[model samples]
Target chain A: MSNNEHVKVPANLMRRFADDPEQADLEVFGRRSDGDRRGFLRGAGLATMGAMLGAAIPFNRNMPAGFVPEALAQKAMTVDGKDGLTVLNDRPVNAETPPHLLDDDVTPTARHFIRNNGIPPENTSADGWSLTVDGLVNNPMTLSIADLKSKFEVVTERLVVECGGNGRAFFDPPAKGNQWSLGAVACSEWTGVRYSDVLKAAGVKDNVIYTAHVGADSHLSGKDGKLAISRGVPIEKAMNPHNLIAFAMNGKELHPMNGAPLRLVVPGWPGSCSQKWLKRVWLRDVVHDGPKMTGKAYRVPKYPVEAGQKVPKGDFEIIQAMPVKSLITTPQTGIKMSGRSMKVGGHAWAGDGKVSKVDVSIDFGATWQSADLSDPANPYAWQRFGAGITFPMAGYYEVWARATDSEGRSQPFGIAWNPKGYLNNSMHRISVYVS
Target chain B: MMQRLLPHLFVLVLLGAILLAPGRPAWADEDELGGIPRAPGAEETYYLCSACHSFRLVAQQGLSYESWKETLVWMIEEQDMSTPEPEERELITKYLAKFYGRDRLARKLAKQQ
Candidate 1:
């Protein structure tokens, strides 16, 4: 039999067989010999089967003897709290939004992508939760959610938070971590106190050069003391007033998966720098050498390396501001175009810079037409861009969107090869089936 | 008739108790091999790797033999995973490289170019 065609036995029958092998006929398991059936049961009992299922079989008791659960048969998996997301990994729960779902100006909370390195904290209650600012600070402070709202100035700003490995899946060799497509980015209205204000309140010492952020998320290894990931930003970036110690997303409380109660919104940088389930911020005299800080955790090669080439750790530098990138959110990919002229639009963003220009191509980058681009609502918020494209003749056409940053840098047609793929700002393209 | 009905009633009660259970069922704690393809060294690889993370994490990568070895070493040195025995390591690496090689579709596209 082919590897794909595995004979699936229901949980109840498997249990009965485990209890009495002689009474259970081997014919039910399809062409399996008596010895084979015994070995299979011994190796993979009901519990092993449960783990293989990825989730608990809630109605296993009512299932018929030969019934296969829909969960086991279905290939596509959806996350519980997420909508229209492509689940990359269910264990650590890394998911990305489909580009079409990201059409909203301010990405809805459900539509926001989830990029988790470790399991989120089980208990995320804000009532007694507190954020600690310590290490190289003259006045170390621990402020509760209530204290944070009352003591500091509360402000809301729309900001873009994108994963460093947003387009890692497009890499030729493929990246090591989550293979996020284009959807690991969102511009959400965040409500919180300015990070600089909180830092000043804590009295950052002169020796501080970097900030190390810690979260309540548990390590994937199930190890007690091990941290899943702890990344930080340079003190200068942390000191930016645009950075927020965010407590809410949009107008509502932050989603649990998006870091309920508290998180840091360090915009224009990798979302990893924006620590979620934030517990503490440690100011370091030297660069913060925390978990995922040193080596190539978020760092790319200091210089470009050939694809599949090995590079030493010292030759790597940490990624700061993300490159210019844009996405065509309208007329979702593979849509049937009803008319010759279509209003094409999307969002463009540049880390620590403004999107100066956006261009759309109907003939696959051979030629391009400029798209009308809107200025960002805030310094780190993504800018909206729109254009009306008239297809000369409707054959199968692809709409490609590319944005140029204030520095005149545009999205690359080819990927800049790195061992651990990060910062891939390739031009976004969508398919249009025009009759 | 009464005796037959008694057995059926007992089964109903047992099913009700199981269905009404508050948390995950008892079978949830079993060793999950993540339904990885059954191969020569698959069982060993699953046991060794799944101790730290799900086997799906291991299965996700399509790396060369050397890269897989490097990953194993990295796991031991950096990620706090205990070093496996030499034979076990070799078996696991070879199994991974064979099943999930660098011949992924994306890599193929690069090679064609």
Candidate 2:
């Protein structure tokens, strides 16, 4: 896993589908023949190819230029890694931790999914890091990591930080951006100061409508280095007791990739609201129209749009609480079952409130069996569930998990497609083969 | 390592296909600029789109001609991406539609699903 090690790309990108990575004929793929490739390449000139290759000539991060980080690369090479997660992009590195890898009560930092809008800051040292609280406040203040630890109560809570577009790949037409499967979600124990306590210290004004969270990471657009992804939530959500200005994860300092030094942990909302490498929290009068807040970045249809229907500009609604979602982690997709029965378990969470119940459908939603839902450690922590099922025959089967929130909201069978492909909390399905 | 080599190898395989079998382009946009497949105006499209992020990000999405045009307008007004010349826009738009169009995207999605 060292930088100097020679990394070999596995010929196969899929896990359960292709059991033999070594024998996967990546060149021919499954259906595309040699002639099809030749015609496509003939249309695509080598001059262009040569030019792109030239840009990558000086791969000097002490590693390959276009390659993923050493850790991610190593993880993807192993059989377990292939089944555990998929890397969507490498530069601003985006990767999803397979639902099976996230079966644990607390998601390990290494297994946490990464969703970065900008390049991570190189200076991760906490020695000089400070967080400034300004805008719509009576008294603005700046606090360091040590000050945050000593000044305010530090509490630990297990919660899920899910991307808004977690299950986008399953969209019929397929949405834009990372065609993420069911891996863009994970739960972790975060230790930090209560954001409400910080807001009290800052002496927020009554007129404040929103609180903007800013980070130090620079935009990858190459336009301006100072351009960072600064987004915010409503004042009510910002002042919630559960939100945190986290400095540590699982009793350790935050990983650089996970926004080291400090980050906003706004549970139940889109992960983008929890800005990593957090530098500022600016209270605003109107909705904070920062980088991602404008346009249709995080907004979906106000009302459901039929699949493939175009949404008008004003018909969009900003995403707030995520929908009810659950994933079956144990027995993973593609598990070869030697016995007729197997134990299945996973986690579920509701954005607006706590999970009320979870149902497992082994017969592809024909019938459902209620899984025992565990009491949450905290209000926002994901609730764990387990169920045992016996197969009638040896064949292929899909285990679908559906979660319902306290508000009686259950996950939809299929997601309504939007341009940005946000908030896809459809029933999670895992395919298994019984021998 | 293998993660990095995987995309390069896939692109190379697609490149290799140029000889006997010229099939549909494989999913090639998941890395930095280097991973973009070669096509008409491929260089122009990659450089222009990549000024903001990797071409792979752009290549991942499937947008219609009108939606792509709207995306350009939004980029200019919101994301600070520069607008290309009229002629340049036509080329880039055509290139985008050809490589990352709805048809191409359907193939990629169908294969993965």
Candidate 3:
């Protein structure tokens, strides 16, 4: 039969069958005309059909005559293991929390954004998982979860982990990676032993200058032994007491998408530095040349480049502490209010410094008023800020948030253009209509 | 012109289906080319690029032809992608630049503003 002659199956029904064949109504397949079904089966056998679907049909025998499987149903764009996230890409599974859903001070694990560069490792259970600390170490060691717990002092702290490419969607030329908006960040409570403790236990050599982190996630190309991503930080950053080899989030075992059983939580820097599904920590004498470390994977232009400027490879530098940024979590955009007065609140953080202030403006940056900023629960935790703003009159207004770091650096009015579109900490604005 | 390319595109799609058959169940619907409008090289572009990452990643960008060519070169050199024939490379670049070209940048900026 010609391709056009094949009966079209609805994508949702195909997804239902793929997700749970047992729950599927086999009679639906039987409803098709016998002649067409026979022709389809004869033209492309059950094996070929299954191959086209990318898996063997578990209940192929039960599939009655005249059944035609549609093109492999695209996995439903909605994420299976997340809550209320806007999926950008489903293949390597990158989703972001909408600003409305990110209202909680301590972000719920389910609401946290999922950013995966590679397919998550299948065997995420703690039973057989082990972490090896080697390279430039006087005493290389491998430790299990139990051993890690018994040997080191376990600590829990609320820390913010933001993607390096957060707000990339605002880039004018459009970045090459996931077009993350404002929600690729979350401040969650993580429990684990400090990374410094682990490295010290391994007896770091004096010559070690950088750390290379490896994870179990497989590369997208299905290449054997090829890592999905391997990024690291400088030795000084790795040894920061606030950094942790986190195994738990929000008082529970880490979610598989967030790196179950074991992961790194190097807060304040790019989230890529905190490798998920962590397998090894290798100390290196020189900069770690991992899959994403070299070239322009997570780096930005050393100096600011114009929107369409061509940047040479040597001019790019790795992003360290994220620039000062803030997000308005409550009173989501497009909200309509009857009164002139409104309460606005959100969270703010600086990469290596504390958020000194977060100012709110309703007149499109014409004037600014300081919001009451709260102290962080712990180092690296985001500070909550809120303010009561009284509008002059009923009209459409935009609330813009600009956060300043302890060093007095503040968010810019526009995105600082770069080739890779990393580190876009422009001031965030939301729309509100008042009558 | 499209009619001539259809047969070759079908063969490539069939090969992709067969090559991808033995692995894990398809996580993504292979037939659903997100945001990639039908064009001369749509099938070939979908089959080749979707072999690794989502076509949505490609659809998100709006770059000049030179930038798109540089991306393809980067893929071959750094991303372990096999280099395509010169003609095939040109075809893919032309298709990408035509659909996801500099105009997309203007549309995105307007939408955001």
Which predicted model would earn the best TM-score?
Answer: 1
Query: On residues A1-435, what C-alpha lDDT tens digit does candidate 2 reach at each position?
Result: 333223223212333114332222222122211242321123322222222232221222132112223333344532121234556665566778877788899998888888888878899889999999999899999999999999999999997899998887676665667767788888889999999999999999999999888899987765665555789999999889999999999889887878898999999999888899999899999999888887777899888777878788788878999989998889778788778998899999988599999999889899999999998889889999999988999999988899999899998887767878888888888788998
Report lDDT (Cα) of residue A61, candidate 1: 38
**Under the 3 Å rule for N, CA and C atoms, how many clashes does model 2 have?**
17
lDDT (C-alpha, whole model) for all candidates: 0.78, 0.73, 0.80
For lDDT, candidate 2 versus 3, the one ahead is 3
Please give the lDDT score for candidate 3.
0.80
Write one digit per residue (lDDT tens) for candidate 3, span B1-113: 99999978876766555445442223233234432344577767777788887776676677788988999998887677777889888999999898678775333542363
Residue-level lDDT for A414 in candidate 2: 73
State residue A175's C-alpha deviation in candidate 3, in Å: 2.0
Model 1: chain A TM-score against the true structure = 0.84
Candidate 3 lDDT for residue B40? 77
The segments of candidate 3 whose C-alpha lies over 4 angstroms from its true place after superposition are: A1-76, B1-35, B105-113
**Residue B31 error for model 2, in Å?**
12
**Candidate 3 per-residue lDDT over residues A68-184, each given as its tens digit:** 454444333565557888777767778889887888889999888989998899889999899999999999999999889999999999999999998887877777778888899
In model 1, what lDDT does residue A34 have?
24
lDDT of 1 by residue, B33-63 (tens): 3444446787788788777665655655668
Pitting candidate 1 against candidate 2, the one with the higher TM-score is 1
